[model samples]
Target: MPVGSITRGTTNTNRLRRVDRWIAEQPALRHAADPFVVDLGFGASAVTTFELAARLIRSRPDVEVLGLEIDPARVRTAREQLDRTRAGDGHFPAGLPVTFGLGGFEVPTPDARRPAVIRAFNVLRQYDEAQVDEAWRRMSARLAPGGLVVEGTCDELGRVSSWVGVTAEGPRTFTISLRRSGLERPSIVAERLPKALIHRNVPGERIHELLATLDRAWRVHAPMSVYGGSQRWIAAVATLRHEGWPVIGGPRRSRLGELTLPWDAVAPV
Candidate 1:
């Protein structure tokens, strides 16, 4: 049986753009022989799943995307939406390489083909924090070689977001993404941390310290905001890297309001 409960079913067309862009850049998806991606628990609508396929195909033209929902009713709803799109009433190219299935953390794909990348945004937040590891294990076990599980959450409208990159070996990195322009402070992303580190954002925890340091850097670089939010964000991230925070990515990514660090740097206590 599928392994999760129904989520709030809340989602929008571009609600997952941040993560989708990040996933498209990953070597796992770009280099796979037959890239297959899964949008796990893609809530209410298959819009994000279709969006994911559209974005990924730019890197791997033959890429296939599957939208998996544990709820049979949701699976049905998504299929109906797919039908509409195929009928030319929607924006998607007719017969886009996307499908909907009934499954959960188990990630049951038709023909049992392991996916090259599984994007599980906003799914695990519904589970108890303690269940994250097991869920990760289950999903990772279904990954194709060099595959990844990109799990995270984003606020409504896709502005502030965070996700952890997990592989069959283990969790690799944590990334925080903001909208840049209206971003108040880096710490605002704390609310969207992936399930593994959300509760660990309390004082004394590594994740907490990481956010605190970023917030401090943001404030210190407030003057740079006069130039632009991107400059301010770049300066703040540069500060974190200078202070030996293991910040990953360069100006190109930083200018986009994204900061990534090895998972070890912010793993839960």
Candidate 2:
């Protein structure tokens, strides 16, 4: 039996684009011996899995995507969609390397093949904070050497999102990605943090301090908004790094309204 409960199964096309782009840049996928990825808990549609494969293939031609759902019904639905996709009845390429299966945190793969990356977006939002560690342990254990598990949540439209990158060693980085054009505040991501840090965004928590400081930096750089949101975002992130926030990445990423920090910087106290 699958090791998880049925979620709402809510999903939309291109809703996971930000994370896909980030994942594409990671060495785990780019240099994986198998270049296989698991889209754990893909919901009502297989479109995101297809999209992930489509995006990843550019970096790793042999990239194969497997969409997994704990609910047999969702799995069946995704397989049907995959059939139409293969038949060239959909917008996706007929030869897209994608598949669908029924599984959970156990992350079952044929021949017990471990994945280089297990993307469990929005899968943990409905779980208790206490359950996060165990889920991460179970999922990360299924990763191939040097592999990582990307677990996080995003808004329905995918405009606001945040995730944590976890490896066999443990959580390594926390990232926030947003639509820069009309973003009101970087802290808007607070609502979409992975379950582990969502409830931890209260006073005295390191995550809370990080968000509050980011908001301050954004406000200080509000004048740059006239130039463009991306410019303002870049400036805010630069300020964070200048002030010893342990931020990762450079202008290339901040221009996309994305900022990543070592997990220790925002880990719960």
Candidate 3:
């Protein structure tokens, strides 16, 4: 039996593209001996899982994706969708390397194979914050050596998103990715942060401070907007680095409305 409860199963096509792009750049996926990735709790559709596999296959042609859901019914629905995909009746290519399964944070894999990457987006939002650590431990434990667990949340439209990169050693990085066009503030991501940091975005919390600083930096760089949101975001991230925020990446990543910091920088206080 799966080790978790069923979630709302809300899903939309192309709603995970931001994270999928980030996942594709992960060393774990790029360098894995077996490029097996798991899409844990892929909600009401297998479209995102298929999208993940499609995007990744461009880089790692041998990449295989497994979509997992705790709800047996969702699993059946995804499998049914897979059938159409395999038959060349779906939008995805018939040969897309993807499958559907029943699983949870335990991340059950076939033949005792450990996945190189486990993407558990929006799954833990239903779990209590107190349960986050154990869930992380469970998911990370099922990773192959040098494996990664990309767990986070995104809005229904995938415009605002944030997630944590967890490994066997624990959470390593905190990242927020936003669609720059028409984005109001970097802090808009507060509502979509992963369960581990969502509740912590209150006064006096490190996550709160991070968002506040990001918003302020964004405003301070408002003049750069004439150059485009991408330039404005790049300036804001540079401000963060100048202020000693331990920011990662450079103009290339910031232009995409992304900011990554060491997990400790925004870890719960």
Best-to-worst order by TM-score is 2, 3, 1
Candidate 3, residues 1-269: lDDT per residue as tens digits? 78988999899998999999999988999999999999999998888999999999987999999999999899999999999988899799999999888898889888978999999998999899999999999999999999999999999999999899999999999999998888788888988989998888899999999999999999998999899999999989999999989998878888788899999999988
**Residue 126 local lDDT, model 1:** 78
Give the whole-model CA lDDT for all candidates, comma-separated.
0.91, 0.94, 0.92
User: Compared with the true structure, what per-residue lDDT tens digits does model 2 show for residues 192-224?
Assistant: 999999999999999999999999999999999
**Model 1 TM-score (2 dp):** 0.98
The model with the greater lDDT, 2 or 3, is 2
What residue runs in model 3 are displaced by over 4 Å at the alpha carbon?
none
TM-score for candidate 3, please give it: 0.98
Residue 12, model 3: Cα distance from true site in angstroms: 0.5
Where does the lowest 10-residue lDDT sum fall in candidate 1? 1-10
- Residue 58 shift from truth in candidate 1, angstroms: 1.2
C-alpha TM-score for every candidate: 0.98, 0.99, 0.98
Using lDDT, give the best candidate's number: 2
For residues 132-235, what per-residue lDDT tens digits would candidate 1 score against the true structure? 99989999999999999999999999999999999999899999999878778889988888888889989999999999999999999999988999999999
